[model samples]
Structure formats: structure tokens, C-alpha cells
Target: MTDAFYDSHCRVQAEKMNDLAVSDPKQLVALSEQRYEAQIRNVCSYICNNMERSHIVLLAGPSASGKTTTAHKFRKMLKEEFYVNSYVVSLDDFYIDQCRLPTLPDGSKDLETVYALDIDCIHQCFDQLTNTRRASLPTFDFHTASRSIITNDITLGDHEILIVEGIHALNPLITEGLDASKFFRLFISVKGEYSLNNEVVLTHEDLRFIRRCVRDYYHRDSSLERTTGMWASVRAGEKKYISPYKCYANLTIDSLILYEPCIFHHFLCPLIEQMDPKCDIYPRFERLYHILQYFAEFDRHYVSEDSLLREFID
Candidate 1:
């Protein structure tokens, strides 16, 4: 969990990735898949063993740690044991309207900050679930940037598990005054302890930056310049909104792929090449480019969708 530990591991993984790139990328992908499955199994068992009464599990993690995807996978695995199902409620649906929200430090809309969430409504939702009462939830409208509590009702049936995934899911403000015995918490992060040459530490932010670069370009049609420019603010918001409550979890999931940055380099480098000189991305581009030079690239086809990195890379 210290920076030094992660940095050292990043160096070892980078060297390992270099060796795998030249020797066998397929084996490297297989290794990542194995680790991903093991992590899922570990967390699932922890939940099944510890969850006694109502199974309201709070899944918290840094951005891009495959929390949503892991929820889906965990639900599937839980069904194999019993006739139970999980309801995934995204905190994204609770966001306050962007038009009404306050501005960010750099004057852009601070959409990701916890202040943008309506605390009272979230508390009510948790209350409804815990009490076994029917309650309609609010859905945020991204297009018009508004919110409306659902008029339709949903009653929790027998054997229903509520799996909430979000940046602020662990904030005590969201679950304050609730019975601690009725809830379980898990903290997840791309605790990638990979290193390059044992000197440079590959922080989670490094992995996330590349993921955002690829996702922004491919999915959002955003240029690398824009994503790179917004990174500092994004990180600041996460620290403010998500990180402080990590210790509240009963379990932690390390969602990291040792050889991922190698695969990410293939997609990210080309995108980096397109950034204009005047864009604010030049400094990070130069730094990451130097980092990329230390590790070799691998074929994209070797990567599996089950890999923790598939959230961004796929």
C-alpha cells in the first residue's frame, strides 16, 4: 500500500512484461486471467462467509477498477450456489443535476465530486432497502441534466442482494445511523504493484491515465488532449470523494494486470501522437512516452475480456 512497494512491483512487472512480450504474450494474458478469477473468488467467498443477515454490500474502489463488471461477475457466481440474485444500483444515478451543481476548481463542472450527490435521497434509498419497504429511486437524466424520483415501485423479494457500486458508496454520510451489522463493505482499487527497473513506481494513477486516454478516445470520441488535460482535477476529486473511506471496507480487491500497460501502450501511444503541441498534455505525454519506452509492447489479441483491465482496454 505504500508508494515504494507499488513502485518496486511496477518495475518487476515491467521487466516481466518485457520478457513476456518477447517470449510469450499468450502466457502473460493467461496469467492475468487467472489472477482476475482468483480475486473474484476470494471476494465472493469472503462475502458469502461473512454476510449473515441482510446482504447489503457496499463495493467501493477507485475509478476504473472494474467495480461494475466485478459486480456482474460476482452475481453470476453467487447464483451457482443458491437461487439468489443481486440488484446493482449505480451511484451515477444519484448525481445532482449538472446545470445546478457548483463549478469545479478549474471552473469546469465538478460532476464527480460527492457534493454533487443528493445525500438525503441516497439515505432514503438505503433506508427503504434495509426496512424491506418498497421505494421508487431517482434516476438522473444525463441528456437534460436533471433528476426525478421514480414513480413506479419495486419491492425487494426473497433472497435479493443489493450490490451498490460507486465512488461515494463508503462515505458514512450515505449510510450514517444505519445498523452496521446489516451491511458489508469492500474496498477495491487497481492496486497495481508493478515496477519498471525497480526505480520508478507505477501508481494507480498511471494505469488510470492510460485507461482514460484509450476510453476517452474510443468511446467518448474525446481527443487525448482533453482527457490528459482533465486528469489532475479527476484525481483531486477522487481523493476528496472516494479515497478517505477505503479503510471502512471489510475486504479489498486488487484489480491489477501486470502486463496491461504493455497492451495499453499499443492503443494509447497512437492517440498521444495526435495531441497538438499547444495542448496542456505535452508534459504528461513526454513523461509517459519516456516511461513507455522502458517497456515493450505486445499484440492486443492476446488479452482476455475477463482481465481486470478489460474495463478500459476492451
Candidate 2:
């Protein structure tokens, strides 16, 4: 069953923010921070309650959904509030060697498929971690598009939590041999949108796309055009592989930061404006630009370095 907490929380938050005076950007930023912090605290409370019975956490989210940042924040909350340490295992590191990965008809690696991961190795590592509290974690080299020879030795403390996060963490194939009782599953995504006059102005997908575009431009050296071009494939992969398993999560997190669109406007507008008129992605760029016009710009300086927005906005 899908957890109703996040959906309810989003509805309440939207109402609260909408009721606020839109005249002051400072007030909006403060309110956004308050909502974001409360949501984080709620997630931490849920984790603490399950700490005694669950040692493993499987955190799954779609692209630009702030999975990495959420993992970091969860770790921080565990340390500060519960006095527990945690180990993070990235599923991206468990990808099968490039040569063995499944290829699309176009001869490109179909990296989105869960079969691209080395299932046997993951099961073995999880077995070692649960049985002996020790495991060697493999690291994937994105540049080389393969698993690296070097590995990190991780030993989980008696009170420590182990978090495994990726786009496919909730996939049955990855958790095939694992004990469901030993783990807590979480599904996160941007589940809110900006609306005006009963019309949806910006959708959750558009928000995530903005995040991905900003992050891709600065961190991955991907141009706005390239990010927009790849969006269809990303959404297709999510529909086929990710969305079906969302309801399996013990909890769901809405990763939307209400003030994000305003912040994104500062970073994304230039890139959107630069899109070639003749390019196929120009229409999407135009649509996003038009939607952004409804939001009042907020200063990014108010956002902390550790904020979830950092995962996408650099």
C-alpha cells in the first residue's frame, strides 16, 4: 500500500504556503525551510522507531529526486538525534562490467535496466554484511563505465545503520535473496507542483527536470539540450522499472522544496534561453520558461550548503 503520509503532508504544505503572504521572498524562504526541516525530522523519527529491528535501509528515487542528499541528511539526523552511525552502499557501484551489460538496439549500453547490475555479487555482499557485519564494497568508475578493482572495507557497528540507495534499489531483482524483515524501504520523489487559478503551472516532472538540468550542466558537463534530449528515455525507464515498486516502500518522501522553482529560475533561465530554436527540445524549454514566470524569484544564498537542493543546484 502506498503510504498516505507524504501525500497528506504535501497537501497541507501547499495550503500553508499558499496562505502565506507572497509579497515577501524572505518570508517564503523561511516558510520553505521550516517545512523542509519538519519533513526531515519526521523521516528521522520513523527511522529511529525501526532502528532496533531494521539494520538495512533501501532508499530508492528517480533521477534528480535528491536520493543522495536525503541519504546524507538521514545519516546526519541519526548521528545527532539517535547517536548512531551509518554506512552507505551505492547500488551504482554494483553495476556489471561494461562489456557484459545489456545493449540497446542502437548498440549503446542500456544502463537503466536492473539487469545491468551484478546480482550475484550484490547478494554475496549483503550476505556478508548481515552475517559478519563486514563487507567489501565495490566502487564503480563512471568515466570508465566499469567496476573498479579497488574496494572499500566497511564494518557496521552494532548500532549503525546501512543505507543502500539508487534508482533501482526497490527492484525485486536487486533484493531477490534479501530478508524483507531486515530492511526498511523508502521511495522518494518530487510529489508537489505549483498551481494558479486551479491550473497546474509547473508539474513535479518539470521541477525534477529543472534540477537535473542544473546539476547536469555544472557537475556532469551536460548541456541543457542534452539533458532535455535524454529526458524521455529516463522517464520511460522509470515507468517500466521504478514506479511499479513505489507502493512497496514502507515510507514515501516528497522531496520537493517549495522555494526551489524560484532558486532554479536563477540557474535555469539562461540555459533555457540558449536552446536552439530549431532543436527538438526548444518546445520543452519554452514550456518550462513560461511556467517559471509565475514564481517570484528567491535568493539561493538563504539555502544552506547541506540542503537537499544542493544535490541538484551544486
Predicted model with the maximum TM-score: 2
Please write out the lDDT profile of model 2 over residues 1-314, one tens digit for every residue.
Answer: 11221243333233334334256656666666666667767877887787777778899999999998888888888889878898777899999889999988889878788888888988888888777888998999988988898997888877888989999998887768777677788999998876665456778888898999999998999988788778888998999889999988988988887778778888888877877889877888898887776666667786767778988877
lDDT of each: 0.73, 0.80
lDDT of 1 by residue, 1-314 (tens): 12222332344456656676678778767766776777777777777675557678888877677788888777877777544666777787888887768786568787767778888887887788788645677777677888865543556666667787888888888888877677888887877645655565557778877777887788888877677667777778788878898988888887777677778778877766776767666877877776777767887778785555666766
lDDT of 1: 0.73
lDDT of 1 at 161: 73
Q: Candidate 1: lDDT of 243?
A: 88
Q: Please give the TM-score that candidate 2 achieves against the real structure.
A: 0.91
Report RMSD (Å) for each prediction in the order shown: 3.4, 3.6
